[model samples]
Target: MRHILVHLDSGERTAVRLALATELATRFGARVTALFAQSDRYGPGIVARRAGPALEEAAAAAKAAAEAACAAAGVACEWWQLLHGERNHVVAETVICARYADLAVFGQYDPAGDAPVPEDLVEQVILNSGRPVLVVPAAGSYATVGRRALVAWNGSREAARALGDSMPFLAGADAVTVLSLRGAVESSVAGRVPPVDIAAHLASHGVTAEVDLVPPNEAGVTNMILNRGADLASDLLVMGAYGNYGFPFGLRGSNTRNILREMTMPVLFAH
Candidate 1:
């Protein structure tokens, strides 16, 4: 939580993203970097040529807004702009920037408009950057995060990795609930590991956590997680993105896709 890299774009959610980033920076006394990617008009098309000026203006506006917000917050901040011709270039540059950041923040996708960041940017960054990403929902105003967290736990490699990556936030949280759905633990095994083990592990790090076993509900796993998150009044949801390399079109685990599509609270994801 020392250095936070935030993806800035010309979208309605940019304010929410910056607010959350600045909030985190203020909490940890960290530096925030607002990154804007301007696409180059190199294609042989009239639309591409016409889009150049609009894109530049949009990027400039976004940068100005971020700077003003960061200034008002009285936090150390930096602005970065990169010229890219394709979506892959933006992703590559973002990944490179994320390498120097302790955490990366992004806004949820909005498919209705020509957003500066790609619709699948968060998924790509999580899979490629090897860093934790905090995705702010596109529709809400979050005043506080990492105060109370709900960890979506399962006996999988991705889940374990996400739990480990969320140590920084969890350690500072006032309460943490580790939720494991039914059938997550193997009963027939001679030595079965339970969600309590995860709580114990967090306790070892001085983050006292409680284990909660969720029964089979009609809402399915994804909805159950979201319902429970709302029930607990959690500001943050910690979970692992379950998908192979090159996701968004590839085969994504059902729970991961559902949460990405319908998350109400900010979610910390790692893969």
Candidate 2:
């Protein structure tokens, strides 16, 4: 990854993702661009301080934090902002910036927190920017990511794209598990590529990967994936961005919304 674009806001988790982006940049010799944005809609979070000096103060603090972190890490860093724009414009600006970077880092939506950005910002950027997005959970201390990765494999084009996009992480991980839903493979088909094939591909790249299968539960595929990620104690989860073009995306088969809502580990998503 040459360039990493991370979203920054007034929320406390800005430090968490900024730390993550700095770590990745140092690891891969990449530059980090901190994009600070705010939503104009009046709702939970910092929307109440939409007008006046308080908002400007918050934005300044966020920018300063990023600058300090990047300076301490000794990585090339740039600052961008969209301080006076509507909610849609904030999301649009973020997406446009992410399109220029190899990977975009975002924080998962916290329904209970006072988020200064749109709740669907991460989803919109991932699905629209044509870039791999790494979403850090809003509540977690991820000092290290991608050491142990759990990849959700469903034999779809989207899944293939995600696997390809996560090569950097996979090649660096100590262990990787290609987790597939039970009965999700076409073992009988002559030209079909199964999870074992995926493992072989990773092996060719010098990444040791194991193939595992799990049955879907009443809670659904997203729950099953999260459960396994917890079981493996993985720091990163690699999956495809399965969703429509708009918000409230009803993803086919697995619900992208549910994954976004319930994901605890940092997930790298590509469409």
For this target, which candidate reaches the highest lDDT against the unseen true structure? Answer: 2
Q: Show pairs that collide, candidate 1.
A: none
Question: Residue-wise lDDT of candidate 2 within 1-271, one digit each (tens)?
Answer: 8999988888888989999999999999999999887774442245542444655667789889999999999999999877454677788878898999999999998878776677788888988899999999878799879999999876667778888999999999988998864243453453665335677788889999988865433235677778888999999999877733211223562467778888889999988
Candidate 1, residue 145: lDDT: 90
RMSD of each: 4.2, 4.6
Worst 10 residues of 1 by lDDT: 243-252
| Candidate 1 lDDT (Cα, 0 to 1) | 0.77
Q: List candidate 2 segments past 4 Å from native.
A: 41-52, 185-196, 215-219, 243-254
